[model samples]
Target: MSKRKEKTSHGFLNNMNFMFREQWNFEKTAFLFALVFILFDLTVSFIVIWLPKVVLDSINQSISPAAFITTIGTITIGLMFLKYWSHYSEQGVLKSAVNILNMHFYIKKDWKILDMDYSLSSSAQGKIKIERGHNATSRNIYVNMASFYPNSAYLLKAIIGFISFSAIILVLNPIIILILIISYLASAYVSFLVQRMEHSFKDVRAEIDSKLYYLLEEINHHAFAKDIRAYNMKSWINDTTHLFMDEKYRLENHIQTKHFMQGLFDVFLFMIRNGGGYVFLIWQMLTSDMTIGDFIFYFGAITGFSEWLKQIVMRFKNLTNANFSVDDYRYLMDTKDASKRTKGATLPAYDQPAELVLENVCFSYEESDRVFINQLNLKVYAGEKLAIVGANGAGKTTLIKLICGLLHPVSGRILLNGTDSKEFNRDDYYSLIAAVFQNVSLLPMSIAENITFCKESEFDTERLLDVIQKAELSENINELKDGYHTNLLPSITGNGVNLSGGEIQKLMLARALYKDAPLLILDEPTAALDPIAEDLMYRRYDKLTKNKTSLFISHRLSSTRFCDRIIFLEDGQICETGSHDELMALGGKYKEVFDIQSHYYKENSGVKLR
Candidate 1:
């Protein structure tokens, strides 16, 4: 597992690098834009510093009022317009760059998600889908810290700006330069501490997110929500949720308080920097070494550097937060999926025909002792209909899933025509099997598309018509406004209509028929239909399955009468196997179940079931 983790981590980086490489050219463009923006911003600072000196010198001299007024006015208007254009260009180009980055993140991340395993897919949805989305919208807050920027360039620009400010300060006095340097170092240290606190808060948020997901999944899937409410579990839900929320709230507050304290330190440091520089300048002026122009330049330069330092500190905080997101993204990307074999034994591909053989099959999920199937043995001949009858928890659906290659048995071999099923490529093996379960999911598409499973080109029009009639869906289709072409979901805009449960079941049957695979497994296939439709289904199933091997499961005894043979499963073990009449004559579990069902119908409806 450790080795697997390492391998996945390496692969994840390679995948991320490949995705980022596509934007390398755009990154260069952004770099160029950054340089332009920085130069323009620095130029404005220089103007602020030097222009005050020019004006102060003019004021000190005995100059013509008209000339001085005209010169200063012309200079002010031109500088203001230049500043406006440069700032606009900087913002426009940077915004475009950010948009491109967003596009790259979304498109590539979506691709990676689809290719990932089920666990990682769920993880990505939780983290990248939510947190990453929030972060993307907050790009202005974190872009500097996100590792998206060229950090070396940022450092170089800051150094250059600092040098320019220091040079001006040195001209006044070197003491001001020392003050600015001290304040910057102090702010950097405090910002680092605040970032560590923020990271701890983010970890707490992740735990909250996990608990919320569990609550949602349970509410949506299991009978938990209904049972809970029925048993008055509102207090339990409230307590659990509040406990989760309170911890998250407390952590956030702690982090926020730390951040505010860090900001306070920044405020105090700036005051000391500016206050000390001004006090030294006053002393120098009183001693007659400093002029008014020098004082103005020093004040302007110091103010600009202080603002720049604040921005740098904020950017560092942003970087720290983004790093946490990066860590999460990488962890999700590094998770291993379901194991697959490359050079293992191969399953026999059907040519003339195929047979299924389960030899001492045993299976379980993870490390659970509650095994679903244990030492189960069975055989299915080519083109034969086998009915598997069992009570709810007897692993009937599990058996069919194993046969369809959806799962692998832990302790036995499943063979497709004498070859171990695991030897075949899982996807290729599944392509030859068709299944319909009690629980059916329909795609948001037209009725015809759902029937054909969107494989229009491959659908046989004649066979499609025949299957629709067999499944008793012809009447339902004919009643639709557009017949089979009518959309099955109205919420999808111009292509939609609602479908009844029976209509949906008929469509599911049509899909299985359209596939026309060698093996068909139907698990409680008619459970959702009315008695009349179910009776019609059983009557036609024998004719429909003429040349295919099928495994049918049903709680309704009437549905199994058409099958060639019946296998009665009880508590993960096969208790009986024979034809319908033979099993009844034997008077086993099958006969007992059939008699109970038959007696009920006879008494309730005044008509014999068989």
Candidate 2:
């Protein structure tokens, strides 16, 4: 148990060092200013403690009234100036430093999430860590380095004050000093118990908070507004929210009860310490040659001693809580990303079309035993348009992710040109391909910036317009008041336009086109469009993908006829592969699905099936 405690102490110190070093690295001047302010503040506090004793003693010494008045006035003015100076430092300098430190951690957390491996970031455990880390930084001010530093400084002050007061009281009566220490120690133990109880609830509280936050966010989210009203889910949502709230309330009430008990214990200790010290001092004054000023000074010292002991206990509790937060944050930041590459061979130049080969690649999700992609062997020739067709769970999208290096294969090699895909730097390898997934995400930026994924200065305006036109989004852009410069996602910005689903898909296509990567992968890219728009997109596919290798994934089998080759997937393996006519001639599963889909169109319209 001692060894465990020692290890925990060691870890806490290391975490504190890490936080201090990072804060210093973020803003050196702010760090130094904070330290200097702490020292100055501590000096002022010590002076305040000693001033009363000095003034009372001088009064007993029969000092001249005018001289005493002058002395008091000078001290008052000096203290007033120090007070305002301290306040200014707190409001102006310290506040800005705290904000900067918070911003640094916020940015660092976001960077870690963005830079994490896709596999880890997408997992349940990783998401929990992310949420916990966010709570660690945001839930309490004491968790912040700026606040923690000041707490440490105040703790030091408390220790110094306690020792100074003990010395003064001990000079008169050693027994009184001993009684105060024992009582205060008892009070501190109660505070420790309360703190431990609160800490134990941290995880449960975080979970409840997370649920409440999600429910609130979803209720207010524009995306969920329609379904919520249409399904009449207001009462359901309210009830769910209240349930979590009740749980949180119960937990808090329990914690507050413990605090209340601790407060009662503190009051009991306070009476014992103060009452005994007063009785002892009274006895000393009556029996010994203690002056009136000495009595007043010793009484004040005893009261100050009690306050110092309380401060020490409270500060220790706060720092311990802060240490726990630091541990949570460090856990997230220290997580190893399996996909990260420190150094690797650069990707081949993108001047020519890229060839991709998957040699018996296999993969499974971390939480599942069953493989999602099993022995998936395939090759795409340079400049070939390959189509992957499958039902919802047939590993079509997983295969695309594996090829894109978003996911790593469990057992086989994925080669780019002739080199293993893992051999190339991940970011450099990513630059070779542009993909459009079913889920469309648009940043709160001007339409042109979204397309080019660059700033206004870096944008190729002509190329942006060309891709927009090619994606058939020219009409939508022209209709908007700001044309291509209009901001998207009104939820994020005051003046932003929300596009229709079809329009957003077109925008995504334009983005992919603007990238002009050697390889393009479109997964259900035209899912949101009407049949006519989908047909129009397919007709222009060859023109858009000129001189580039492209992979098209769609459940609409008829739309893939334009591809050089079509591979039908079933149960994590390829079931059929050929051109449309060749697959139809073979009468495989592809032909069967194509015939069924064509039958629906044939029945709906008088025209013959294509």
Candidate 3:
């Protein structure tokens, strides 16, 4: 258990280091943008503080109104130009940073969840919350962090302005400067108190994310609420979703109330600062140390700094809250469990007729003590077509995964041509094998692209046409507007039409036929097809896989007749094995299941047998 945790921690650290290194580029760009904005802010602060004093002096000394207006207007125009430059510079850098970060995300996302170490993948599942949980976690992590820079820049400027004001006041009198410092510290304490409340209020965000994930999954997995209405489950889901939203608002409202009270404290602080400044000014006046213009300048400067100081405190508090999102995003991107099998041995040549030998293999889920596959031993030789037949809950799929190097057996080992499967590079091994499962996955692409899977640029188009012909899908393709060039999903690309269930099966068969791998594994491929299509598909499968190594897993007993050998699996163990004729002669589990299915097919096909 300690070893498992140590490995998980190492994986998380690796992912975190990767995320932060990518994030650094974004941080640099934001820094440049924020630098420019901060400069503009400093300029504005100086202009606003001094301009009022200049205008008031001109008025008392009988200076021309026209001159005063011209000076103010010129300054305002200059400030406007600076503001535009700041805004443009900030936006441009942020957009660039987001693009670079998004590119990294796109490249890394193709790594499958199943490929990671079990402990790491389990940890990643919680952080990234994929599927119905973490799938909706925003892809805008970079943009969100980049956006924080502009606000931080404004906050920095406010701090600088306050410091400048403090310096000027100190020159006026030390006592007055001391009072203002005290008031500022008091205001900061209030901000910290309010930030704690905000932290508590923000706890509902994860719950909101979870609720959104389930709602999305239900709508999509249930076919956009149509199935929900069919089953009359709309009210239950609706109420549950609403409850989540209400809880989110409840938290948000709590934060707002705390902020409002904080605002009240700010107002009171403002009154104290202003009232205290006036008393000091009166003392300065009595001592005959400063001019009326000097009094006006210091008073205005104090007011300006106080307002800006409140803004600074407020932004600092907001930054604290923003860190929650930053941490959440960092956790998702940096979780080490996302990367595994950094290196492995290269797979050997398939020339030796790659035999799969599982010698007492075993496996279990993350927390499970009971093994899913226990001391399981099996073998399938090259050039021999084998069938793995089992009920739904039997470990048929699990066994196939073990062979494909997708899952590592917890105990014992899987071998290919007498070499341990784990010793070979998993990616290279996968390239040598072709697998189609009950869950058919077709990319949204052209019919030809889907068939070729973008792997071979120079495929035998003639062979593809031959496979389509054998699969009996020629008429369907000819009826299509674009034929082979037609898009598989017209809804996305407007090039192809939707395929019927039978047509999809034929297209899938064409894809598998085109690969012509040394070992072809088909998992319940004909389950959705009609008897005629299924029969035709099996014939095509026989022609395509003739003399090549193949493993066909099917519930239909008629399909197993094409195999050179059959292995009947039950409860993760091979209960029976033989040729179709030999199996029937045994008159065991195989005979009972096969005879029943064969009789049903015979009745449906209107065929009679002695």
Q: Which one is best on lDDT?
A: 2
Candidate 2 residue-pair clash tally: 0
Q: Give per-residue CA lDDT, model 3, range 100-159, as digits (tens).
A: 445544334334334444444443244243331232124553334333444456677788
**What would the TM-scores of all predictions be?**
0.75, 0.90, 0.79
Q: What is the lDDT of candidate 1?
A: 0.69
The lDDT ranking, best first, is 2, 1, 3
- What is candidate 3's CA lDDT for residue 156? 77
lDDT of each: 0.69, 0.80, 0.68
What would the per-residue lDDT of candidate 2 be over residues 1-610, giving only the tens digit for each residue? 5632422343667877876777667766655555555556655665676677668878889899998888878887887777776665545444544665568776788898898878787776677677777876773465553456656666776887788778877888788878878887887787777877786776677778878998999999887999998999999998999999999999999999999998988888888888888888899899999877677778778778888888998888777777766766777788886664767776666767889899999999988898899998999999999999988899999999898888899999999888898887778788899998887789999999888889989998889989999989999999989999999888887799998877887788799888889998988878776555666676677677888899998777877788999999998899999999999999989888888888766522324555
Write down the worst ten-residue block by lDDT for model 3: 127-136
Higher-ranked by TM-score: 1 or 3 = 3
* Ten-residue stretch with the least lDDT total in model 1: 144-153
Q: Candidate 2: lDDT of 576?
A: 94
28-111 per-residue lDDT for model 1 (tens digits): 465566667677767776887788888998889857899898878887887797688668756645564466556655554555
Candidate 1 residue pairs that clash: 145-319, 345-423
Whose TM-score is greatest here?
A: 2
